[model samples]
Target: MQVETLVVVPVVLVAFVFYLTHNQTGLPRVGKSGPFGFILTALKSITSFADLLDEGLNKYGSKAFVVPTMAGSLIVAGPENVDLFKSSDDTAINQPISVDESLQLMHTLNSRQLALPFQAVVVRTDVTRAISAFIPEILEETRLAMAEAFALPFGEKSTTLPLFHTMTHLVARISNRAILGPSICRQEQYLHDIIRFAETLSIYGQLLTWFPRILRSPVYFLLSSAFGGPKEPARAIIPHLKMLLAEREQGLENAKTITDFLINLAPPEEIADVKLLAMRVLSVNFGSIHTSSIFGTHALFHLATLSESELDTIRHEIIEALESEGGYNKASLAKMRILDSTLREVGRFYALGVVCLNRVLIKPASLVDGIVVPSGYNITIPLKPIHFDENVYPEPYKFDCFRFSKLRASDHTDLKYGFTTVEKDFVPFGLGKHACPGRFFASMELKIMLSHLLLNYDLSLPGGAKEAPKPIFFNSHVIPDTKACVILKPRVGQAGQDL
Candidate 1:
């Protein structure tokens, strides 16, 4: 009886899933069809999603296809239909809903964050507008961070540092210097909590997706850091945030940080809530620290492989830009066209994911050829494939640091190829109105830090390796080699040129 019960239960569940998925979409599928196929595809999605996308595009051409995942089916639209992804009809296709569904934010994070995105709004407005004013702060923090993270001996000696870890540390400190302020940003405990929270949220969010939706909230509540099952660093930072909020109420006016902007932009009723404000800060840190550090590491790794003369070419551009503009301000950074191209090229090469512009349809939407996508289906653009399209980028796989700079030189009148420019083809920061609002700030921050590194130090792969370690790809994320090390030596005869 017991053996029969076990076999029957397995059969029943598979049959039920098969029933639910049958005829769910009219679009072509990238993998085998049916419940058993779904299981296989879901496993492949976790391990080799990019391969799955490549197979889909190769098989279906420019037509849309579905890729199954643990979360749900993703309707991947090809390059030809990218404009449909730029639709502003929030009621039909919504990016926030897609994010919430993808990350399971309603359970893992505070649902209020999804509903009230005051932090993002502040980033889109206050952060971008204040970039020029905070240039000195960013550069100072970059200098201090580099000195501390890579404290090598002067002349004929070098220190090897873990690339991703050091970049994260540098970005966290420098970004928080702009996000919170100088004193709090430097606090060891506070910085630890912020980094821990971002990591915890990412891990737990993906973990929770494997469970049934009905059990997710209960599972999260039971195992969350508040209950001592998992680490919730957001809770750890509440007191520090409350104190900051109190200081704000007591007339501590700081117009330069996100804290001030949140207070300025948030509704009066939500302003004094410590948990709300703490979560907001955590969200901002997660977005800034994780993504910036990843791409920063990518750019540095590519730079590490370059010949000394190639490095000098970029260094010379930075020095000229600084001299031409008299300082490290917005205008000066803008003049560093090669620096911008280097960063942009790294993005185009080591993209963040296999797809972008993910949206969840709340209502039925029709596309070309009278194909109607049913409500609640997830949609994504094939970003990685588009980035590597031979028709779009010549020698797309090569790490040509001057790719965009050469493009700009040809046109001379077009800013479309700039680092911050977003189009259908090049979309590391995403595309359209819902694109990353903090890109202007991120671009400035990354450029400043990279410029500082170029001027003050020389970087090479440890042990004289010709290339940096290969980046790791898991599920959809393209992460820089987290454990890779780079040798850093003080640049000779470049003391006064440091940012």
Candidate 2:
């Protein structure tokens, strides 16, 4: 009787799931079709998310299709359905909170930060305004990071380091100066842990999802630090954050930083816990550092391939702008237009994800031609194909350094064509109302690092090659090849430039 019950229960459950979803509710699937196929597709999706989505796009061709996940299938909206994604409201579909809920961020982040708009209160506002104050320190950190990492390679003698690792560290230190302040940023142990925390977000999310609902909290607690690199640091940093908060409370505020802004946010609660506030700080540090470091590595690789003449041009632009604007102010960074164009083009060419601006349905939502997404499914655009569309980017696969600068300089140009400006056709930073609020700060960091590199060093690949090392792909995420080496030789007249 017991054996029979076990087998019958699974059969009944399968029948019920198939009945409810109607095999993902008759959505056209990317891989195989039917109930058993979803399991196989889910495995493939985990192993290679980009390829699974690409297969769906190739098979369906502008028709919305489904990519199966371990939990269920997600609707991959086609180009025609971009409006459905862009114009949806939070009540209908939510962006961050929806994704965060799925990832079980409630267990990870401070409760006060759960639905609070970091865009308006923290990530976007304070950093964008006070970034200029950080430039002198950022330049100093960049120089130190570079010098320490590459030993002042000079003349024909160059320091060869893995491009990705070096950039990750350099960008981490620079981002730390902005996000955590100079005192904490310089601590080697703390810096190491923060970088580890950023690199493991996926691992943590996956670990949490492996357990059933009742077991999730136990699993999170058991494997806390193993998941996100922030767990241990969160515990250690609480007392320090408490000190900062107490100082603010006692009206001892002097320099307002990311710490002050986050502490000062008027959350739903009248008085926020200091521990939760510390976790919030760690969250911002991990996310900001991870994105900036990875993208900065990509841009640096792009520069490593530039001709000596091209190198001189970018360096001169940096110097000319710095001299004109009287040091590294906002106007000076803004005038480094060539660096901006290169950064944009690298992002366009090598973005890690196949789609952006993912919004999970908060409620059942209707679409054109009788298509309705039931609650809980995500709506995502097909990004790679649109990026490669000939009409959108001419010879789209080929990298062009000035692709966006020319667009900006064009007569009667729409600024949307520039790489930083996200539009329907371009969304490296996403599009519409929820486009990345931290982009201004990110752009500033990228420009500062790249400009510093050009102004201080001669960059090349080891083989005297004309091309940058080919980037590797993990599913859809393009990454700098960790094993590949980049050669850097310092130039004259820039030895103590930042110091």
Candidate 3:
């Protein structure tokens, strides 16, 4: 009798699932043949995400096509349906759902405790107004990383280091200084744990997202347990966090950082719980570290591959800006046009992913040309062509470092194109009301780090400038060559070793 009951339950679940999927309406189906063919094609698409998107673009670049999923079909489109994202309201097209689905944060983050106070911190402190005061400290941190962490030669001797691993440490130190205070940031143990914890988040976070809807709950439970039981990142960093939160609780703290902001973001009733506080820090680290390292590493590779003439231009720009601005102020960092433009080019070619502005339709959406998108559909903008199409950018395949700077020089141009400048076509940060709010501060960090690298080190790729290292794409990320190495030598008049 028990065996017969289990068989009946399984058959019922299958029938219910099939009926539910079949009833999903409005989305134009993609792929050949019927439902069986789509199941096979969708399975293939899971392995080769980029190739699948490219195939879809070739067939339906201008219109929305449904990518069949177990839950139903998802609405995926290229430039033609970009308005579906840009012009849609957050109420109709949900941004939080898209981010939550892609990153699997809801499994780890508490609904009550997940308010983002860091954006408040960034806007209040690190944007144009308060970041000026942080310039010297940032410059100091970069130089400290170069000398102690990097240990570049004081004299003629230098070292060959793996680009991704080395840049990870450098960025960890810099970002930690800004997020946590210098005392915690400088600790060897905290640095190792936080960096490793962020890396683990990337590895495990993506694994959780691979499961289909039917298996999501069970698969998530399995992987989440293996990933140190949801409080893993917090558990790893909480030792450092506890001491500081205790300090603040006792009113013994004089300085404030993102930790203070996290406390502020917490609900008043539960703000004192150090465990919840650590969770907030975990969220910030999870978002910042991976993206920061990706852009930093890619820009470093390009900097390593630059010609002597280009290097001279970068060096000259840095020197002139620093000298004119009376040192490396926020204004000085802002004025490094050559350095900023180079990083922009790197961002364009190697963004965090090939897709952006993803939204899940909560309320039904109506588009122009009599198209209606039913609720419960996921829509995404394929950013590959918007970034690289020849029609948008002439000679798009070539790497022109001064691409935006040249554009800024046009006769009627009023605004200079910095890395943070977001236009319709130029959105490495993202698009719309929910676009990356921390871009200004991120640019400052990247520019300062890159500026110090150019000013202090003679850089090179492993084989030669000719051998271009390829970026690896999996799911949504464009991962730079983690295994590639760069040779470095300290400049003659550098002042960072003793710091």
Candidate 4:
């Protein structure tokens, strides 16, 4: 009787799932008819959605039907949709559902009020004004931090290191300088703790995202309590920020940095929320450190592995720009066309996230001629296909640093899409309003780090080591494999050129 009950229960559950799925309405017709048949086909195609999108785009042109998962159907539009996605009418497209686990993880590190504080901070004009006002000071701090970080271990007797580790330290120092000011930024322990906090938060968040929403908070509490809670790493720095906030509040008339700027924007009622301010500081650190470091590492790796002639060309450009402009200001950095192209190429080839922009439909909408995406469906542009498309980027697999350079030389103009300015065919920093606001600071940080590294060190793969670093692909994200190494030696005659 027990064996029969178990067998019957399994059969009944399967039948019920099939009945609910088939009876459900709004399943769009694709290359076939009938709900169950189409769903079965989609289930088989789920693992190869990237390939399916590519095939659909090639065969049907610019639009394709995809099942976001086994249960959801979506119609994806191509690059033309970028503009549509950016416009006000498209604001109806909801923010993608964050994994409950990820949210719970964030909650552990930050209060609910702090973790999801009005998106206005990122998407509105007031924040833009604050950022613009802060850029010059931010750049200055970044330059000083870059110099100090590289100058360490003193005499510089050929220090070779992993790209990620080098970048993590450099970015942490630079970001801390901008976010927390020089006194705190220069402290080694503070920087290390911030990185540790970010790493821990990301791991917990990723783990939690796989579970159902109802179970997330309890899971987070259990895991965090067992795993040393957010306070473990945060303890080193939170008190300092609170003290800084208090000092700024008491001396409101004299404060001059970003913390001051943030304070001024707050109302009297909001001024006392030190915990909320600390969360913002931590969020800024997480965003700035991880993405900037990853991209910077990729840029340096590409530069180190490229041929000497290529390296010389970029170096010459940098020197000429510095000589003409007197230093690495925004204008001078912009003039380093080859460096820009190389950076863009690395971002393009590496393609930050396998899936680029993510959106959740808020209302049922017809995308193209015959495809409809129901409300609540999640959608993403699979960047790999677009980035790797041969038609868009000829010989897409090969690293051609000159790819964008050739285009610029021919057109005599930087690439512009309406009001958006971008280069070549890359969108690593993303596009439109949702684009990373910290990219300017990130660019400055990368340029300073790379400029110093190139001017002072000779770098290469270890003897007989493979020419190029191998990238490990995990769930569409590409990261340099841990085994890769580069050798660095002090530049013999370049000591006098240090600035």
Candidate models: Cα lDDT each? 0.79, 0.71, 0.69, 0.59
| Poorly placed runs, candidate 4 (over 4 Å) | 1-80, 88-91, 96-157, 200-203, 226-230, 252-257, 267-270, 414-425, 464-467
Ranking by TM-score: 1, 2, 3, 4
Put down candidate 3 lDDT per residue, 1-499, tens digits, no spaces: 6999889668855764463345265555655556566665555555456776777778866576676543346677556656557666678888877776666665645543224444445444444354665667777888887777557555548788888888888888887777776877777766776777677765555665444455556766776576544454465457766776688779887545666556555565545576766766766766677788888888888777778788878788788888888877777877787777777887788788877777888887765545777887777777778888788778988777778767766733534477887777777787776677667767888888887787778888876764458888766567888898888877776533122
Quote each prediction's TM-score: 0.92, 0.88, 0.86, 0.78
Which regions in candidate 3 have their CA more than 4 angstroms from the true location?
1-32, 68-72, 78-84, 113-129, 152-156, 212-218, 224-232, 236-242, 411-416, 493-499
Task: Tell me the tens digit of each residue's lDDT in model 2 across 103-188.
Answer: 46766654445566553457777777888887787878887777788784455467888888878888777787776677777777
Order the candidates by lDDT, highest first.
Answer: 1, 2, 3, 4
User: Which is the better candidate, 2 or 3, if ranked by lDDT?
Assistant: 2
The local lDDT score (0 to 100) that residue 488 gets in candidate 2 is: 81
Best of the two (1, 2) by lDDT? 1
Looking at model 3, report the run of 10 residues with the lowest lDDT sum: 111-120
Compare the candidates by TM-score and give the number of the best one.
1
Model 4: per-residue Cα lDDT over 356-416, one tens digit each: 6566676765553445666655555556566787998889988776777777777787643
Query: Residue 250 lDDT in model 4?
Result: 88
Model 2 residue runs over 4 Å out of place are 1-23, 118-120, 152-156, 225-228, 266-272, 412-419, 470-476, 494-499
Instruction: Mark the 10 consecutive residues where model 4 has the least summed lDDT.
Output: 415-424
- Deviation of model 4 at 481, angstroms: 2.6
What's model 2's TM-score? 0.88
Clashes of each: 0, 2, 0, 1
Best by lDDT: 1
Residue 263 lDDT, candidate 4, scale 0-100: 55
